[model samples]
Target: MPTARPRLLYVTDLAYPARGRRYGDEDVFLTSRLRAEFDLALCHPGDAVSLMDAFDAVVVRNSGPVLTYPEAYAAFRERAAERGTPVFNPLTGRGDMAGKGYLTDLTAAGYPVIPTVDRAADLHRLPETGRYVVKPRLGADSAGLRTVTPDALRAVLAEGAATGADLLAQPHVDFVHEISFCFVDDAFQYALYAPRPDRRWELAPYRPTLADLAFARRFIDWNALPYGVQRVDACRTPDGGLLLVELEDLNPYLSLDALDDGTREAFVTAFTASLRRFLAV
Candidate 1:
């Protein structure tokens, strides 16, 4: 007798109008591939909490920014935890899955990240630059991100303080280009980069050097998720060193379309194997 495949409730927002990215196309391609190994059902993120209990695990991908549906996301997290339903990325994620506060944690730990602070008094910790970036600690996809002068940032923080809003501030780094390291489980898969600084989604295949892989691995080591996918985004400083931009552990938009057929297939295989391993545990 053949073994039964795991049932996976895949959560995504296919209609989300992501700037310079195709959330629908990527998720479509991925779920199509994933269907070979699992009984997969795709649903809008809003419906995940209701649908997930019937499946063996929930694979959250391209669900859009939680800022758009904070309450729904919160409920989903709560329900999943209460029922002990296996989540693909798992709730233990410490990076973007949790929130941008990880940036402040990394900064304080002296990780190679753009210095981030959330309070008015902590502003002095960041180096003085022409401008600083003020963004919500829970923000994603550049939502609620802005550049401002130091004085303006202080005012923003002051307002946040008054309103009790979660916010973070960081020095604007003059970086040469942005790159991302994609991984399945803890193993590296592929890398992509934006050659043009202005175009964040205009990605091209990047060949990582041993040094580059080492730098990206630092965050992977930090998060230490036993399974699931991750993307380590970083920028090249003028001094030829890398500073982390973000570590996306939850539903990272894998530029599968950008990869060659072989590479894309390899990612699917790795992802499938990871899911099986995750199920075993």
Candidate 2:
């Protein structure tokens, strides 16, 4: 039912005011490139539910955290399901899109993920650390994350329990650096890393080894997304092994500017091809 050039409803918040990054600039660049292949219109996350039905598919990017507009997001999801509206990230993601619960599941299953537990009673499962990172299960973009002492960890979890809010706790990892593997439709596109964990947005291009690719690929295969972008974030341990920090399956930032010209062009080409393939289905 699509015309010569299919219509795409590109969802984004151009002025999200995030920390250490310009979400608007990145999205403007992406949309400019994407316009070459499709008739695209960008809309705010709050407007997508009302405007999406007219477009062939909706591409969510730079929309910021769901907590900012929970009601709008829930309505969007509900309407999309009722009408079977095509979403690029496909709503069946089992990773962060669902919640942080997958981290605990992966930990229990013996994956290389940093050990995580949702309930206070499960604290014994996590390694002993002077400080633990306690975060809300449904949080994103470090919205409800905190680093606290052991006593504070229990107090916070208990307080969350009293209020019927879900939380997860993990040991603070002492890693040499944080690396991210970017992918498009289950295929590896490129990789980047930050030497100093304190400066998360200051990234440099990384040449991944076979073992490194294997480590990242395992999580990609586990997620098994039909189509869309994914970023597998991991930390390099002192002993030269990687641990899964998080699996970002929904609207993961591509960080295209950090890449060289050739690599950036290749990524855009692959992303366009992947979108075409996704639309075909």
Candidate 3:
């Protein structure tokens, strides 16, 4: 008798209209490759809770911003956790998976991150800038993100406090460009950067230095997930130092299209191996 291959429930929102990236294209490519290894099925975020039980593991990829389906996402998470299901990137992630609260935590811990504060009283801790960014703690895809003068920031905080909403404030850094370091199971995979900040999705291959890897590694270590992929996003300041922008441990867009054929193939190989190991555990 032949052995049955592991089944994987691949969750994605193929129709999600992302600003610069094509969530559907990426997932379509990924699922095509993943199918070679596992018996895979695609479903939207709204259906994950009901379908995940039929699979051996769940691979959450390009599911789009959870803010759109907050109740469904919450229910999916709760069910996955309660059933002890193996979720890629594991639901235990402390980075973007949990919320933006980690920014304040990393800031307080002296990590090289954009200075962040979550309260009116703590605003003093941030440097004086012409503009500050105010964003919801649970925001994604630039949702609820705005740049405002200090006065406007204070007002926003006051309103948030009144509504009991969690928000984070950060100084508007004048960075030259933004870069992201991708990893699979604690291993560095590749790096990409946007030379023009205005066009964030125009990515090019980036060759990371020892320092860059070290910087990205800190957050990966901090997250401490024994398995799963992660993307450490950072900005290059005028001073040539990198500061953490976002540590994406949950369903980060791989930007596979930006990569060369060889590089894209390598990523698929690494991703497949990672998934295999994850299932064996």
Candidate 4:
């Protein structure tokens, strides 16, 4: 007799109205393909905690921003950890999965990231720019992100300090383009870029150079998640250098629609294999 296929609880917010991208379509496409090898059931982020135990593994994909349901997300993480349930993107991710605090940490460590400061006292560390970007430490999908003049930024930082709100400030970077390197378990898969900064989701396939791959790999290596997918987001500065913008380790959108049929099929193949490996562990 054949063995039963692995059961997977795939979490997603199908109706999530994400700007410039169809969250539902991407997940629908992914789940449809994933069902081929696994016994999969789709559920919303809010339902993951209750349903996770019944499945062999939980695959969080396009679940939307956790900020929308912080308590539920926190509970899911806590419960999953306590039970030692296998969660794809393994709860061990240190990038966006944890928070934006890594930005400041990376900056302080001399990584090629946009200089970030979480406290008003560290404002002098940033380069003098006409404007600065202020974002909440736990922000995702541009939530609580703001651009302000230097004085306003300083005032805001001071206010945040007084209120004890976690915030990070950085000099606004004037970059030529934004690029993302997609990877599956430390292996580079593919890359995509938004040529027009104003239209962030209008993505085009980008062929990464050796240097670009090295730049992205540095962050992936730092994150050090032994399993799960990651997308290393970066911006190309005016001087033609890549700087880390965001490292998404939690439910990073694959933008599968942006890839041609062959590439998309390849990604699906890789993703399915990764899931099998994750469950075997």
| Most lDDT-accurate candidate | 3
**Candidate that beats the other on lDDT, 1 or 4, i.e. the better one:** 4
- Put down candidate 4 lDDT per residue, 159-220, tens digits, no spaces: 98889878999999999999999999888899999999999999999999999999999999
> What tens-digit string does per-residue lDDT give for candidate 1 at 1-281?
11388888999999999998899999999888888888889999899988888888899999998889988899999999998988989879999988999999999999999999989999889998889998988898788899999779999999988998889999999989999999998899999999989998899999999999999999999999988899999999999999999999988999888898989899889988898888777
| RMSD vs true structure, all candidates | 1.7, 1.0, 1.5, 1.6
Each model's lDDT comes to 0.91, 0.91, 0.92, 0.92
Q: What TM-score goes with each of the models?
A: 0.96, 0.97, 0.97, 0.97
For model 1, the run of ten residues with the poorest summed lDDT? 1-10
Task: Indicate the TM-score of model 3.
Answer: 0.97
Per-residue error at 93 for model 2, in Å? 0.8
| Reference-based TM-score, model 2 | 0.97
Winner on TM-score between 1 and 2 is: 2
Question: In model 1, where do residues sit more than 4 Å from their true spots?
Answer: 1-3
* Candidate 1 TM-score over all chains jointly: 0.96
lDDT of 3 by residue, 101-220 (tens): 999999999999999999999999899989999999999988889999987999999899899888899999999999999999999999999999999999999999999999999999
